[model samples]
Each structure stands twice: as C-alpha cells, then as structure tokens.
Target: MSSTTRILLGLALGAAAGLILAWFDPAHAARAVQFAQPIGRLWLNALQMTVVPLVLALVIIGVSAANDAAASGRTARRALVVFALLLSAGAAFAAIVAPLALSLLPRDPALIDSLRDAIPAQAAPAAVGFADWFTAIIPTNAIAAAAQSAMLPLVVFALFFGFALTRIDATRRERMVEFFQAIADTMIVIVQWVLWAAPLGVFALVLAVCASAGASVLSALGWYIALLCAMYLAVTLLLYPVAVVFGGTRLRRFAAAILPAQVVAASTQSSLASLPAMVESARDRLGQPRAVAALVLPMAVSLFRITSPMQYIGAASFVAWIYGIEVPAAQLAAAAALAVVVSLGSVGLPGQVSFMATTMPVTAAMGLPVAPLGLLLAVDTIPDVFATVGNVSADLTASSVVARAEGSSEPAAPA
Candidate 1:
C-alpha cells in the first residue's frame, strides 16, 4: 500500500481502537494514552528538528536564485494578497455563519456550565500591539530564534541573509547558494526518513487524543464541536473548487497531492511539522517550480494561516451565541479585522495558545465572556485536525496560484 493509504489506515484504526478502549475501560485507556503521549511527542520532535534548518535553507536558496529583486517582490506581494483575501473570506464566513448555525442547535446551559467547570482557568496574555507584532518578526539573535523555533524571526533573518548574497561576488554568491541548496537537500532527506514513521506516529497521536478526551468530552460540547467541524469542512471543501477553477489545478490531482501533508498536519496538529510534506507535494505532485514552492510554502507556513481567522472568529461567535450576546454588525467587522491581524501576527506560537491569545482580545472587544474559551480549548482537538488540513491545503493552493502567476508553468526539475 502507498504511504498515504497507510497513514489514513493508521488514523482510522487508531481512532477506532482508542474509542473502543475509552468505551470499555476509561481508566486503562487514560493510562494507555499517557504512555502513547511520549511516543507522539518524540515523533513530533523529530519533524520539528528539521524545520529550522529546512526553512532557512529554502528561503536563502529561493531568494538567492530569484530572477530579480523586483520580480521577487511582486511575487511576494501577490502571495500576500491571496493570503489576505482567503483569510478574510474564512473570517467572514465564520462570523456570519457560525452564530446562525449555533442558534438553531438546542441550548443546554447545564452542559455548558459543566464543561466550563471541568476546564481549568487560563490567564490570557496581554494583547499584542502593532509595534510588538512587527518588531517580533526581526530576530535580535538568529541563533536563539532558531533554537526556539521562532518561525517569523527566522524567516526574516533568512530573507536578509539570502538577499545579501546577491550583493556579493558572483562566484561566491553561486557557492553560497549551492551550499544552502545542499543543506536543503539534506534536510529534505531527513524529513523523508522521519515521515517513513508517519503511520505509527499518526496512530499513536490519534490514539492518545481519542483515549484521553473520549466521547464524553465531545458529548458535553456537541453543538459547539459540531459547528466548528462543519465550518472547517465547508472551508476545506471550498478550497478545492477554488483551486480547480482559479488556480487550474485538478481536484483529484490536488487531493491526492496534498493527502500526506494533510495527514501529518491532522496527526501532529502542527503545520510546521507538515511543512516538508507540503514543500515536497508542491514540487513533486502539484508541479510548482522549485523557486515558487520554496518561496511560497515557507512564507505560507509562517504568515498565511488560513484556518486561524476561521477558528478564532468561529469560537468568538459561538461564545456570543451561547451567552445571548448581541454582537452588532460593527463589532463583527471589528472582530474580522482583528482575526486577520492576529492570524498574521501569531506565527510560531503553538496552535492552541495562539488561537486563545489572538481570539481573546476580539472576544473582549465584542463584550463576550472570556471564561467560555477554556471550554472551547477543551473541545478544540478534533476540530483542529480539520483546521490543519485546511491550512495545509491552502499552502499548496497558494503555491500553485503564485507559481502560475510568476509564469513558471512547468515544474522545475527536482533537486
């Protein structure tokens, strides 16, 4: 069987096994989940270990080999515009649709109260200002940023370092580009080795999640969970047609291409972990040029999180609907704007923490209770899988669109 098929099978079997265990023996299942957590973490660490070096090398080589600074800047601007539009659409859809869908669901105050009680309180960080957001992108210490997996700062440093090569002697520049290319090629090999364990890793990860959270946790927040899943599914489904119609990608081709990356994203719940798969898929399956894949995918991972706006806006809207808070049109607009800014700014943070930090201010702005966030976080795991899939799909779609626009109609020869 193909690796993608194996990964899918692992997901199904692991979830089934976990659910059965949870149904039969909650205590033992919890213990099993505890044991599996470390295995899953180890797998995730193995993937993350490649992210810094891989991303840095990709950015450096892509920039250094660009046709010209002006052309590269135009490509970057086009990518950003596409990213912003997609984010806005997601946020708007969630803001408009979630509240209406949530209203139709049967309200259960008792269940909501119980869920809130079960979740421990977490203090939200102070809101990030525009200055702090922009400043954080530039690394004060590149080494420290890499060590911490600070993606935005590391990307910024890589861009500067890559551009600096263009100003040097031609021979030296070519040598440096070749060196980074070698590093990138090496990291891609390491990523492939890591992904060979994907089925096992995905199984462990999914098993841990299902065993620990169980059906009971989901039962308590059924409506909320259902709404988020529905929204994520809708957005994910919509992306395909958009890619096909506008980006000239075939649906089957796109789906098959992105499957491995989507699976990794679903299992690991970290787009950074799935970056290698995305880059590979874009180059090999989607037929994007090397420069476009390298340039677009890394930047997309760092800046263009399409799911963030949807998730944050959906969570906030759900909270408002549950509490009978009337968020005016103006407030919803403000929330959408905030969602875009936060989604763009919260690069490199853990998915959940970033969601909370970015959404908290919008919640406060809309006059909704912040306590419900803990409950949202509690049930966010399953929904996160779909969200990650959406993000990875968008990464590939964006790459294809950008590549086509840049006139790289044919895929570059694989490195």
Candidate 2:
C-alpha cells in the first residue's frame, strides 16, 4: 500500500477502536477490557524504549552540526539567529493564543462551577522564586534522573557528551560519533518495526482510555478543543508566515510544500513519529540538503519542542482559573520563561506529559490537587494533535530558513 493508504488505514482502524471502546460499558466488557490494558502498556513501552537513545543521538548530532555551523562565518550566525527567532515566534504565538482563546470561550458558569468543585483547592506556590527552578535540574542520581526521565539533566548529559566529542582527537571523535550513530540506527530500526504495529497499539490505547474514563471527561471539553485548534491555526497562518518573510523565504511556497506533512502530523499527533515524512518533504519539495535535513529534523523532533510548553501553558492557566488562583501578569511571564526551560530541559518523546511534570516548579510546589493535571488530562488528544502539527510545521519552516542561509543552490520554493 501507498503511504497515504497506510496512514488512512491506520486512522480508520484507530478510530474504529476508539468508537468501539467508547461504546463499551464496564458491565459489558469489564474482564476483556481489563485484559487489554496490558497490551496498551506494552505498546507504550515499545515507543518509550526508543525515547532516551533517540533523544541522545538526535541531540548530539544536532548540537554538533549547529556548533560547526556557528563556528563558521557570518552566514551561519545569521541562520542560527533566524532559527532562534522562528522558535521564539512560534512559542510566543502559542502563549498569546492561549489567552486570546480563553477570551473567546463562552464562560460556562455552571460547568466552571462544577469543574471548580471537582478540583480540590490548594495553596499556590509560596513564591515565583529561583530555588525551585534551580532544584529541578540538579538531580542527585543520574540513574534516578533517567528513570524519571528528567529532561534537563538528560539534555545536559547529551550536550556534555556531544561537545566533549568535539574537543577530543579527530580519529577518536569520529569513532565515538560512529558508535552513537550505530546505536541510533539500531533503535530506529526497532522503532520502524514497532510502528508497523502502531495501528493496533493506537487503537488499544484509545480504547483503554475511553473505556476506563468514559466520554464524560470530554463532553464539556469542546471549548478546550476549539481553543487548541485556534491556537494551532494562529501558529500556522500568522506566526509562521511572519517567520518566513523575516527569514527571507517565500512564504506562500513554503506553506504549500509542507501541507502534506502538517496534515499527517495532525492525524498522528506525534512530531517524532512524523519525522520520516517531514524529512522526505523537506528534502524533496523544500529542496533542503539531505545532510542538513537528516541532522536537524530529528533533533528538532526531540529537542526543539515548543508545543508541549504551549500545552502546559494552556493547562496551567485553565487550572489556575478553575481553582480561583489569580495568576498575575508577572506570574504568566515567569510561566512562559519556565516553559522554555522545562521544554529544553526535557527528554523523551516530544509532547509527552512527563516532561511537564519534571520541569514545572508548580508541579513540585503545589501538591496533589495540582497533581491531577485534570484540565489537560481531559482533552489531551485534541490538543496533542494540533500541537504536534504545529511543532512539525515550525521545524520545517526553520529548516527552509537554514537552507537558504547556507546558500544552497536550490531556489527558495513554496513549502
């Protein structure tokens, strides 16, 4: 089957499973659904098994390449600056859209009251202080950090190893790079095989979630989904075009070229999973160099995740409002800055919730009431889909800027 055919098949099967599971009452399929939970767990494990190594390899390669380009003349500096600007714009757009969407949403006083009641009130963090931020990154045990998938420490370790490789003898550095590359390749092969079965896995996972929780969680969440879609649309239509113009790329062409991948990302709800399609699109349609596309796209998948922060921002804001906690403007700014730190400091798959758990000072300072993360946990699927699409789209746009700055012979084309 064609790639499109496969994607459609997966989507259809996954949707079928979700609908069936949603319709399943505990009285009807308690034992069978209970039995199916472990299968979903196993599937999650398959994806997670690749998480650390995939992140380490991709980060090492990206920084190494970025460092090389940075060490070059003015052109490379310009490219790096443009890429940074694009990232900033995407993140800022997400943050702005959250508040704007909140404004547009019809405040359901009754539903809000019910949700507020459901949420246990807790004391806000004592202060927006630095101690909490400092303590989050410096884990006592490397193993414990890895077990918890502490993103900052993991990123620190990967950066340390990559840069350290640069300073060593050329022959040994090559050997070390090759060693990591080999491991990365092996893991990618494993991921490919598992992805072949992902349709079943995705279906089972959705089934488990629906069966256990029921649709009540999302019945009143239509507004949340709409808010996320608006945010996604803002990033794509407004921020990205501005980025393209600023970066000296042809804005119309860039968006056109990347539409296929963006659509796929929306369906898959995973930037990491969409890497192959993004890379292919960048190389073939966008005319990016294979070397640049290969190195940057994977790194962007693992490291340059802006959307997770956006999700966290939206979740945090909603939860704060639900709890009647006043988040001052200063706190929102602090939250945005912290969002960047938490995103960069995180490891594992892009869009994973654990990263937020690890990076947010609020998660630590606020207790169990904050623990539920109820707002996001309710509408994760909808937001995750939109965010993943935006994340990959932004990455592709940055790649175009980078390619142009590198002075590649390929003329600027519409993406």
Give the lowest summed-lDDT range of ten residues in model 2. Answer: 359-368
Clashes of 1: 0
- Candidate 1, residues 109-205, lDDT tens digits: the string is 6434433332212332245555665576678999998886555566678778987988999899889888988886776677667667867776776
Alpha-carbon runs more than 4 Å astray in model 2: 1-83, 108-117, 124-220, 350-369, 411-415
Candidate 2 lDDT over residue span 260-287, tens digit each: 8988898887787788889878888777
Give TM per candidate: 0.58, 0.58
Model 2 Cα shift for residue 161 (angstroms): 14
How does model 2 fare in lDDT?
0.57
lDDT of all predictions, in order shown?
0.70, 0.57
Residue-level lDDT for 47 in candidate 2:
55
Q: How good is model 1 by TM-score?
A: 0.58
